[model samples]
Target: MNSRAPLNTAPPGMAEGLPVRFADVSWDSMRHDIEYVLVAPQRTRQPLLVFLHEGLGSVTMWKDFPYALCEAAGCRGLVLSRWGYGQSSPRPGHEKWPVDFMHRQARDFLPAFFEAIGHDTRADPPWLYGHSDGGSIALLHAAACPGRVGGLIVAAPHLFVEPVTLASIQQARDGYVTTDLRSKLARYHADPDSAFWGWNDVWLNPEFKHWNIQALLSAIRCPVLAVQGHDDEYGSMAQIDGIAQEVPQAELLKLDDCGHSPHRDQPARLIEASVAFMRRHRT
Candidate 1:
C-alpha cells in the first residue's frame, strides 16, 4: 500500500471467522487451514458477495471495505485468505508456484474453500469482488464454474501478461529486498516471506510471462464490471479494455487520479459504481 493510502480499520460484527480446514488442496495432497470472515451475515435474504484480495493481500488486509461494501449494497459477504496468505497455511519453504497457479486457485482451491465455509455456489451463487491477481482468479472461477458465479466486480485484473506488469513486479521485488516492505507485510500476513515470495517468485518467472486467460472470458455467463485506474503502475488500460473485447456484456470503468487499488484510491467512486452495477445484475 502507498504511504498516502488511508488504512482500513476492521469494523465490528464479523461473524463465523477463521481456522476453517480443507483437505487435498493440491497435488501434494496437503491439508490447509484457510482463514475467513463473514460480514453482515444477518442479511440472509440478500445476495452474497465474496471478496478475493490482491496478490499480497490477506483477509486482514481487506479491513472494513468488505463490510462497508456489503452494507451499502445490502448484501452478505464472505471474505477469505487463500492458502499461503494472511493467517492461513504458509507456503512450504522450497515450494514454487507453477505458471498455472492462478488456474489451480480458480479450478480447485476456490471450490474447496467455498465448500469448507458451507456456501454451495451451485445452490446459491455469490457475486465476486476481486482486485489485481484476485480479480483474475474471480474471472477464472466464473469461467470454470459457469453458473456458479452471480456476477463480478474485478478491479485491475490481468487477463494477459504484459511488459509493464513484469516491470512493476520487478520493482516490487526490489522494494522487498531494500525496503521495509517485509515488515509492513507482517502486519497482515502471519508469514510475510510466504506471502511476498510466493507472489513475487512466480510472477517474475520467465515462463509466467506467457500466462494468459482471455480465452476463458467467453465462458463466463454472468454480468461483469471491470474497473481500472488511469494511473495504475502495474498494468495499462488494455487490461479492462481487453475485457470488453471478449465479454461483451462486461462494463468498463476507468477512474482518474487513481492507481492500482481503486477501492483504496477511489473508494467512494468505486463503491458507487459497484453498488449500482451489482444491483443492476442482482437477483
Candidate 2:
C-alpha cells in the first residue's frame, strides 16, 4: 500500500516556506517512493498548481521557483520528483527506458501519483505548470484526461522532435562523460548515472527519433499558455507554434534573450505571465 511520510528535513538550500514530503507511489508498475514538496498547503481550497520539472530535473533542482510562483499566484503547489529523479528511487541499472516513457508518465504514472497523494482530480482539477519534458507530459495528460485538468502553462514543450534537439542531446551525452556534468547532477539526484542515462540514453536512441505528439494536441480541451525562449538552443519557435496551431485557443509567450529554461532564465516574467493566466482562469 502507498503511504505518506515526512522527509527528514528541508534540503540545505530549500526555501523556508516549502515543506518537503515523501509519498510512496506505485511507479514503473512497482512500488516506489517519490519525493515531493508542498507549498502553501494551508491554501487548501485554492486552485492547485502542479509543477512538473524538466527531463533532468527534480524537486530540489527546481529550487525556490515553485514557492515563488505559488506565493504570487496565491495557490497551493505540488512539486514532485518523478520516479527516477532527485531523492526518489534510482532507475535500476539493468533497465532501459522505452521510447514511450513520457507517454507512460502522463497516461499511467500521473493518475496513480495523484491517487497516492489523496488528490481527487475529477472533483478539483489542478493547473499544470510544466517545463521541457515535463511540459510535454502535461500536454499529454491534459489531452488524455481533459476533464481532470484545469489549465496548462507549459514552457519549452516539445510536440515533435527536432534536429537541434537531437544535437543538443548528443552534446549533453558528451558533457556527461567528458565534463563535470555528472558531478553537478550528483548534487541533486541520488544516483546521478541513473538520472542521466535514463533520460540521455532514451533520447539518443535511434528509434526514439520518430517520437512525436502533435496528433494528440488536438485532444486537449483546456486553456493553454505555451511559453518558449527565443534563444533556446534545443528547439525553435516551431515547438510552441505547433502547440498554438493544434490547441488553437492556446496563448503563446516568447521571451527575449532567454534560453531553454524560462523559469530559471527569466523567472520574474514567467511568474508574471503564469500568475496572470491563473487569475484569468481561476475557479
Candidate 3:
C-alpha cells in the first residue's frame, strides 16, 4: 500500500466558514492510512457527525452535504473514505475485501480514525450518517460500540444481501470490465480497480448471501433514524424496517418517488428529517 496519496494535503475550503482538515489513520493489515476531512462547527462542542460514503462513494463523492447538514444542525462533521476509495490509501490490485469489510470498518477503522483525529470516543461520541454500504457500516459500528456513537441516520443500508443486489453487482462487474464504468470511476478514485473490486467481488461472491447482520440491529442502543426511498434501485425498505423491528428506539422515514441517493434525489426532505433526528438525539 502506498503511504502518500491517502494523506491529507490541505483543508476543504473557506467558503463554508467550517474549518476542514485532512487526516490519516494507520492500519495494521496495510501500512497506508485512511484519509478524512474534519469540519468543525461554527459555535458548538457537540458530538461529531461522521459521514460514511456509499459503496461507490468517496470523500469528494459526498460533495457539500456534510457541510450543509452540519451547519444546519450546528455540529462538527467528519467525512472519510474507506481504504479503497476516495483520497484514502489505495489497496493492492489483488487485494480482496473480506466478507466482514463492513464490520472492519465499523469496529476497527472508525475507532482508529476518530482517535487519529484527536476526538475522544469515550467523551465525544460521534453521530454516524451513513449511506448505502456506509449505512450498514454505521449500524454495525453502533451495535459494536453502542456507547461510542450518539445517534445514527442511515439511508439505504443493507442488513442482508438480497438476490437483486447480487444480480445488480454481477451487472456492475460486467460493466466495470466491458463498459465505461472504469473510466467513470477513475474520475473519483485514484486507483479505480481498488475501489471497484473491493466492493464488487465481495458482493458478487456466491457465499455472501447469508452475510446478514440484522440480528446485530438489537445491539444498537442509540437513537436511530433510518430512511429509505420508495424507488431505491440498490436496496429496499427492508433495510430500515429491519432496524425499526429490532432496535427499540429506531425512527423510520420513507420518501416517495425517490431513488437510492436520497441526499441527491430528495435533498430537502433528507435534510429536514436528518436535522430533526439529530436534534432529537442531542447528547
lDDT of 2 at 96: 88
Which candidate do you rate higher for TM-score, 1 or 2?
2
TM-score of every candidate: 0.91, 0.97, 0.91
The digit string of per-residue lDDT tens for model 3 on 1-283 reads 2234433343333234433344567765554566566676444567689899999898777777887888788888878778888767887887788888889988988887777667787887888999999999999999999788899999999999877678777888898889899998887788888998889988887778879999988988899999899998778788888888899899999999888899989988899889988887796
Task: Report lDDT per candidate.
Answer: 0.85, 0.90, 0.81
Best by TM-score: 2
User: Worst 10-residue stretch by lDDT in candidate 2?
Assistant: 1-10
The residue-by-residue lDDT of candidate 1 on 32-65, one tens digit each, is: 7776666777888888998999999987787667
Report the number of clashing residue pairs per model: 0, 0, 0
Scored by lDDT, model 2 comes in at 0.90
lDDT score of residue 29 within candidate 3 = 59
Deviation (Å) of 83 in candidate 1: 0.6
Off by over 4 Å in 2: 1-4
- Deviation (Å) of 141 in candidate 1: 0.6
